[model samples]
Target: MTTTTPAALRAAAERFGDGEAVADGSVRLSWHDLLTAAETVARALIAEGLAPEDRVALCAPNTHHWVAAVLGAQYAGCVAVPVNTRFTEPEMAEILTRSRARALFVVGTFLGVDRLARLQGFLDGVTVIRIPGEGDRPSPDVIEWDALGAVAERVPVEVARARADAVTPDQVSDILFTSGTTGRSKGAMTAHRQALGVAAAWVECGEVTSADRYLIVNPFFHSFGYKAGILAALLSGATMVPQAVFDLDRTLELVERERITVLPGPPTIYQTMLDRPGKRPSTLRLAVTGAAPVPVVLVERMRSELSFQTVLTAYGLTEAVVVTMCRPGDAPETVSRTSGRAVAGFEVRIAGDTREILVRGPNVMLGYLDDPEATAQAVDGDGWLHTGDVGVLDADGYLTITDRLKDMYVCGGFNVYPAEVEQVLARLPGVSECAVVGVPHERLGEVGRAHIILAPGTSLSTEDVLAHCAERLANYKIPRSVEFRTELPRNATGKILKRMLRDG
Candidate 1:
């Protein structure tokens, strides 16, 4: 039985051997080749002086390098910290500093931005390894990805293999940072057992198999992409075909060319495909999606038009991924309306008068990294992780997410916390008071709307506010609309009533 991620990788290599493991564009890696590459990366990191249990940050989009780098980090008994590629330089710098990452595996260039060059100011005492991207530029200080083999020569391969074998199930495997109501991102630590356990649950629930060719369109920074996309494929021996960016034309071309079997994405992806004027035939058979609400029509059309045999919606947060998922044969209404029942040894219950969703399971995160007070509040004494989303459970035990308790919203399948946006908005020169709220958006499920009150005699245009946000925040977190007001509505206790703002 596989208990850890590295073990799962090793088992896949041993069992599948020459079977294709990753197919990224022209680069194809068999299971055995993947293992050899990951081992080389492990040896390189060991030689680079990354101690066991130290943190290593990866800031890149979905690619073959991401898969190997993360697995290599785990093989060396180090924790992998996946950084969001959409974040600004300052945001990325903050995460690197907060995680205390000893080394960074970053892309040289992506989307016309020189990631490594932009981060040069903040990478003190940290080893920088550059991954290949679109624009070709080399820095003397940064180590090239291909040079890992040379670095590995300094450390014996046997030592790296022993380190991979020595990895225990209880060791912290990854630190996934998620934003909270406090306007700060907290690193949610997950053990090797927890990570693999959730991936196994997702694989079983989705009915993933070795013959499956999974198209991972989601970004690797998110849990759904890494745990459900990569780790689940590792456990099930599915071929991973990662798409770094989600272009409708490219997605359709890949679907037809690669004979992709499992395609999991947000509801918008299916809707867009269905609306395409000239849709291509696809081999898509299974889809497990949830971030925004899945409409019954969308679910039906996915089966009818997109040729998906199974369409499942699931509910999960950074703390406990794959908490609830719809089964293969569930009714369309059940699949569309609810997030299915609890899986992976998790027990779900609606707690308190607020109807907050509470989950308890072996897969619950160990804790927020290095923040005991925040961890105590998140996970109670009874071991229930207080998922700050309001939900309802029907007689059949299916959970329907109705509202959010954290004032957080999902924008284009990414979590956008209002507090985080408000914090950024407050930094604007003319902004005296501001409250951000999630408003309905046709395409992006929900988007932020900033209600601002400027200082006396100070004026600012919407363009200025948006421009300021564009520089500091990710694209999804930037408010879609800005409303200037004289004052914000508040209760007697002086707390701004965000519900009123959202309602208006």
Candidate 2:
């Protein structure tokens, strides 16, 4: 019943052994190999003087190495801090400095940019370990990536497993920083119990198994990828195929070639796949979509056109990793419309009249790292973490997220939720997608600005868009300005970058 991540992984390696556990570009590792390599990396870090509970930052894209680094840190009794490779130099520095990471495992390049070059100034005095990629030359200052295995050869596997088993559930496993959409990202200190609990719940709710070849399109830096994704795959013995960068064509080929069984990501991922309908493998069984509004039509398409056995939509945040997930047997309509009921271990409730979603569970984080004031503000005295998401709990305990409490804008002194407005735009004629943001108004404090992406060969005038909203929403809720664009701005995870819109 102990919920240590390393111990659980050791058990998985024992059971699955020679079965394929992970696959990168051309490299595939059996469970036994993967576990041994991870422990090797841990031993290497220990030799470099990383102490228990010390943080080691892993700054790289989705790959086999990223998984190994995280698991290796767990095996060494250190906390893994995953850096968002897409972040700017300052953003990455903030996480590294805040986590107080003494060692860094990073890639030289990501998405055609030299990430190692940018971090050179910030990473002074830190023990650097380079994950060698193509075109990367050997550096004397940085430790070679391949040396980890040789280092592990010196340390006994029994000693590594003993260190792993000695780790307590209360030990901090990882410190994940939230995407700073609203403000500065805070490090959420998550214990081994919380991480394993959430991963196990995701495997159960997402219906992932050893037979499932899980294609992880989501980045390893995000919770959707790290916990619910790669970790969930390991817990269930699913083979993890991580995609460093999501490309429509490449992803389709991988899914078909590998017969990916479990695939989960934001709605935009499915939208892109749906737009470019091609030869996809029939092996896709379960699809979980969340991190944004889940249109009922998208869910229907995934089930009917995409040939998935089950399509689920769930809602959670970096603080808890998972809260609600649709059961495997739930109605398709329910799965599409609601974010399902709370997971077995968590309790969810709408707080007072504001209807802000509040969660209380073992999955909730211990607190914000080194920030007691922010932690107190986020979680109430009653042990409820106040999730700033605005939602409505249906009669059946299902939650439908309407908008972020911060995203809601008052138009002409009337309340307007952008998700509600965006939903109306989605159903409008000739509209393919739309995002709504609040803009400062002369008369009102803030007014909704609608950015529409029209369907191919379709056109909608500003007058027509305003007229369409006139029928669905109140006069105050109607968007005053309509801008048509070829595409809306989105983050790596497919969530709209509303802050960019506000600044632009």
Candidate 3:
């Protein structure tokens, strides 16, 4: 369970050398292949002058190289900054600038690679390494990924040995950027101990084993993906299947083909898959959803249609990974109704008037990198990370997420949970996805408005949707108006971009 050091990967490589590590379509890498590739990339990075604690930005989609590059960076004693592949040039530029990254690795053919290419000028002093692609030649000043690995000398065992001697659990591992309701993104500096502790706790809570094959659909840029998906698999010696993007059909195929047992994703992903035409994988034993609220209807449909053994609802954030998880033994209704109790090694409490959820644990991020003022605001002097999510913990320890503190609204002296309203909208026929935000109101102080994406070939008028909500929810909880869109604005991890909705 102690996976604080990069040596854990070495351990896995030695123990499960012939076991599968990653599979992307026709390409598959066993533990031996993965370790060799990581070592090669690590040597290349070190040869390029990256030192211990240096920041290496990774902007690749989910691919074998993505995992390789991360493990390689860790092997070289460098901190990996996983960039959101969906970021605009300006956004990417801001993160690159903020992290003060010396090098950037990009997957070349994803939907937004061109946008990254457009920002090459913005990354003037930084080295840009492009993963190979067919239609495009390497841009000027950009180094080909394969070329770097070919010429770079392998890291001598002595170097790794020496660095390993000095590396400690408290050393910073990742700087994850989280955009809260206000201001620019803050870089949450997660330490090696914290990240590994989260992975350990997750492995324990989920009962993960070496026999499990995990399909990692969550973007590695986020802590949920890094600790929950990658590190958890590493600690348990489970095979990891990486998908750069979440395509419903392809995910289903991978699940069935790989005989994947453990699946972790947001509710949107599972909902999309249930709507797709396919047989659920027989080997899938546990289906877990988090990062957003799970609609009651979606949970019902997943169980009734997919026939998975259990559906678990989890809750966590960039600062603290896997804070709570509903156990498989919990009733299906309980799992569907709440985000579950606090996982091992974490304490959760509801705070102040709005009942914002606060967390304290070894898994909490060390602090925001180089921003003490922001860190002070986020983590109290006593060490709890203010999650900013409002919720209540029942006497029996069940944690029910009520709403995001920032997303709550007062409608004529009544508090309204936007998540509650959005959940209702999501259940309406033809609604594929939805986001709710509060807009200024003269009499009520604030009122809710919904931005919605309709399912393909389905449409509903604003009045119709509102009418449907009236049947299920109190009038104050219903959205005052609804806006239709082909797709809801989302961040890289498929989280609805409420800032856009608020700004609009």
Q: Show pairs that collide, candidate 3.
A: 62-244
Ranking by TM-score: 1, 2, 3
- Candidate 1 C-alpha error for residue 121, in Å: 2.3
The runs of at least 3 residues in candidate 2 whose Cα sits more than 4 Å from the true structure, single-residue gaps closed, are 153-158, 179-182, 408-504
lDDT of each: 0.92, 0.82, 0.77
lDDT of 1 at 251: 91
Predicted structure 3: lDDT? 0.77
Q: Could you report the Cα RMSD, in angstroms, for every candidate shown?
A: 0.9, 10.7, 10.3
TM-score of 2: 0.81
Put down candidate 3 lDDT per residue, 1-504, tens digits, no spaces: 554547777778888888888877788888888777777777777777778888989987777878888877777778889887766565678888999998888767666246446676778777777876535655668778778666356556466545544557788888888654443567888888788888887887788888998989877876667788888878888888888777777888888888988888766667667767756657877777765556677777777777667788888877887899888777777887888898858999988786989999888888887889889999999898887788899887889987665665555433466766776677788999888888766434567898888889987998898888776554556788888887777899998888788888
Once fitted onto the true fold, the runs of candidate 1 whose alpha carbons sit more than 4 angstroms away are none
Candidate 3 deviant stretches above 4 angstroms: 154-157, 295-297, 408-504
Estimated TM-score per prediction? 0.99, 0.81, 0.80
Which of 1 and 3 is the better model by TM-score?
1
List model 2 lDDT by residue over 1-504, tens digit each: 438888878888988889999987799999998887788888887777777898999989889999888998889899989887766676688888889998899997656767677777777768888887657866777887887777567667777777787789999999988633334568999999898898898888877889889999877887888998877877889999999887888888898888888888767777778888556557789988775556678888888877788988888878898899898888878987899989949999998889899999888999999989889998999999998888999888899887676676654323356876787788898999888888876445578899999999898899999988875554556898999888878989998888889889
> What tens digits encode model 1's per-residue C-alpha lDDT throughout 360-406?
98999999988999999999999999999999999988999998888
